[model samples]
Target: MRASHNQHLIHEVLQWNGVIARRAHLDLSQTIGRMLRAGELVALLPGVYTWARWAGDPTVRLLAVAAWSPDAVVCRLAAARLTFWPEVDHGELDLAVSDRRCSAKGFRLHRRRLPPEHIVGWPLLGEDAATDGRGIVPITGPALTAVDLCAELGGEPIDRVLRSRQARLADLRGALECTAHRSGNRDRRRVLVESRAEPWSAAERKGHRLLFEAGIGGWFANFEVAVGGKTYYLDIAFPHLKLAVEIDGRFHEDDPDQFQSDRERQNAVQLAGWFVLRFTWYDLVDRPKVVIAQIRAALARCRKLAGIR
Candidate 1:
C-alpha cells in the first residue's frame, strides 16, 4: 500500500512539473529514493528526476537542465528564442554561468558574468509556469541576446527584429556601447555599426543592391502605405509604378501571427492599387537573375499600364 502511494506521489509530481529535484522529493518519505533505484524514475541530471516517459521530451530535458543549474542564466540560441529573435530550432540547451562550474547532458555551457540589468528573470515558460511548479529561469534581455547573436552568428536576426519594430536599433546600440569594455566585444560592435547602416533583412539588402546595380530608379526602401485605416510598410516600392517588392524569410511561415499579418498587409496593398512582387531568401540570393528579371518585367508592365512609356 505504501509502495502504491509512493508511485502515485512520483507520478503526480512528474505530471505537474515534468521533473522533480531531490530537494522536492524529501517530503515524500524515502520512497522516491527507492523508486530511483528501481528504475521507475530516471535521473536526468545529478538530482533531477523525471518519469521515464518524459525523459525523451526536449522541453522536459531543458527544464531538467534548468533545475540542475539554479544559478545559471539561459543564453545563446535559447536566449535568442526567448527574446523572439529569429533562429533555427536549437538542439541543445545553452546557459551562461558566472561561477560554480555547471554542466549537464544536452546543454552547452557559456561562462560570463552578466550585469543584473541585462538579466531578465521569468518563469520557465510563461506567467502561469509557477502553477506547474516550474521556477523562474533567468534569460538575457533582447538587446544583449541580439548583440551576442550578432557577434557570433551574423546580424540577419537583428535586422529582422528591427524590421518587425519589436525592438529599437538605438536601444541595441546602447546595449552594445555599454558592453564595449567586455572581452570580444569588437566583433559585436562592428556588427552593430553595420546594422545601423542597413537595418533590414538579408534578402532585402541583396535585393536592394541588385536593383541599384541594375540601374533601377525611383524606388524607396521600406515605403509606407496607408490602407483600410491602417499604416503598412512595403519592403521596397516604386512609387510612380505603384509596385512593391517583399523579401520573405522562414520566420513568416513559422510564426502564425506574422504569417496572418503578412497576408492581410498584402491584401491591403493590392486593394490600394499596388502591384506586389514577392521573393524568398533563396529567390534573392540563389536566383538574383530571376528576381531582377521579374522586377524589371513588373516595372515595364506597370509603365505600360500607366502610359508612362
Candidate 2:
C-alpha cells in the first residue's frame, strides 16, 4: 500500500483513540512499522505508538506512560495532582519503578522498591478498552504522595494537603516508616514534628506546639460546637470554660471570602456564649511567647468569669 494510503488507515485507527499498541497481525504490523519509520507515528514506548498530534498532550502522555509500564506507579506531584489536591504543579510526571528505566522525555523517574501498600491501583477512565486493556494504572496513595513531595518541597505542601483533608497523618507516618530512607529521614521527621503530630493546618499545628511547650493543657484541637443549627469546629477550644481560639493563616488574608467567613464563624461562636480569641500566623510562629501569654490571660479571665479556679 502507498504511504499516504497507510497513513490514512493509521489515522482511521487512531481516531477511535489517540493512542494504540502494536498488534500481532502481519499486514497491520507492516503498515504501523512503515508509518513509524516515516515519522508519521510517534512511539511512546516499546510497543506503544500515537499520532504526532496527540504526543505532546499531557493526559495522552500519561496514558501512554501508564500503558507502557503496568508495574510502574505514578508518584510525587503527579499523584498529588490526580487526587483531592489537583493544584500541585510539576513540569515532569513522576513515576516509581524498580530499577527499570524509560527514555521518555517528560518524566522524572524514581527507581525505588516501593512496598505494595504505597502503590494503589487506579483506572484511567474515558479511554478505549481495546487500546487501554482494563485501563488500570498504579499510582502512589495520598500518604505516600505526601511523603514523596515532603522530601523535596518540604512540609508546607504536606501540611496544606493534610489541612484540606486530602491525606491523614497516620497514613503519612505509615508511608514514612515503609519508604523513607537515610538521606531524607530528617526532613520526613521534621514534617511530622512541625505538624505537632496533628492532622490540622500548619499554623494550628504550630499553635498546638506552642501551647504544649508553655505547659498549657485541657484544650482540644478541632473541637466541635453547634451554632445556628450547624456544627462548627474550633481550631482549639476549652469546652468546659467556653473558650475558643482561632489560628488564622495566610490563606485567610489572601482570600477575602475566607477572611469574611472567619468573622462570621467568630460571631457564631460568641453567640453560643463562648469567648473567642483570634491569632494570626505570625502570632503563633514569630511571637509564640506573646501568643502563649495572651492565651493564659484569656483562660484565666474565662475561668474567673465561669467561677473556676
Candidate 3:
C-alpha cells in the first residue's frame, strides 16, 4: 500500500507541473529509481524528471531547470517568452546562476551577477499555474531580458517589451549600460537611441524616422486613445492637433476581416473629433515625399482650424 501511495504522489507531480524535482522529494529516491529503470520517466536535468512524452516540452524543460536551481533566474529566450515575446519557440532553457555555472543535459546556466532590480518572482506557467498552488519562479526582469536578447534579436524585442508596458525606456537604458561590454553593443546603442520614439512596428519605425528627419516633433507613437467603449491605440497621435497617422502594414493588408475592422475603427475614431491619415508600406517606401507633403498639409489645416499658431 505504501509503495502504491508513492506512485500516486509521483504521478500527481508529473500531471500538475510536468516534472518532479528530486530535491523536492528526497524520500522518493527508491521509487524514482524504479520509475527511471522502467522507462516511466526521463531525466530533464541532473535531478529533474518528467514523463517521456513531456520531456521535449519547452516549459517542462524550464520547470526542470528551475527545479535544479530554484534561485537561478530564467534568462535568454525562455525569459523572452515569459516576459514579452511569446512567439519565441524551440529554445533550450537558459538560466542565470549566481552560484556554480554548470551545463546540464536539458538546460544551461549563465554565470553572471544581476542586481536586485533585475530579478523578480513571476508565476511560471504550468497546467494549474493560476490555481491555488501557484509556484512562483525567480526570473530576470523585463528590461534585463530585453537587453540580454538584443545581442541576437536586436531592437525588436526592446520595442516588444515597451509595447507590453512591462519595462520603460529608462529601464532599457539602464540595462543597455549594464551590458555595454558585450558584443555588437555599438549597434545596440544605436537602436537604443532610436528607441526614444518607441515605434512598435517596422513600418512605424520608418514613419518615425521620416518625421524626425523633417524636424517634426510633438508626436506620440502607439499612443493610447479611448474612443467610445473600445480603447484604440493610434499608430501615431498628435494630441495637440488631434491628428492620427495609421500605418497600414502587411498584417493590415492580407486579412480581409482585419481590413474591414480597420475601416470600422477609423470611422469610430473620426467620430471622436480626430483627423486620421492612413498610409501603407508602399506609400511610405515608394513616394515618401508625397506622404510627407500630405502630412504637412494636414497639419497646417488642423492647426488653422484649431486656431493654434
- The runs of at least 3 residues in candidate 1 whose Cα sits more than 4 Å from the true structure, single-residue gaps closed, are 1-4, 27-30, 85-87, 122-126, 131-135, 181-184, 207-223, 237-309
Cand. 3 Cα-lDDT:
0.81
The residue-by-residue lDDT of candidate 3 on 163-190, one tens digit each, is 8999999998898777667767777778
> Which residue pairs collide, candidate 2?
none
Model 1's TM-score against the true structure: 0.69
Model 2 reaches what TM-score against the true structure?
0.86
What's the lDDT of the predicted structure labeled candidate 1?
0.77
lDDT of each: 0.77, 0.77, 0.81
Best by TM-score: 2
User: Model 2, range 36-132, lDDT digits (tens) per residue?
Assistant: 8878788876677888777887667677666577677888877887774688676788887786566567776777778897787666655465255
lDDT of 2 at 186: 85
Worst 10 residues of 1 by lDDT: 190-199
Name the weakest run of 10 consecutive residues (lDDT summed) in model 3. Answer: 126-135
- lDDT, residue 192, model 2: 74
Write the number of the candidate with greater TM-score, choosing between 2 and 3: 2
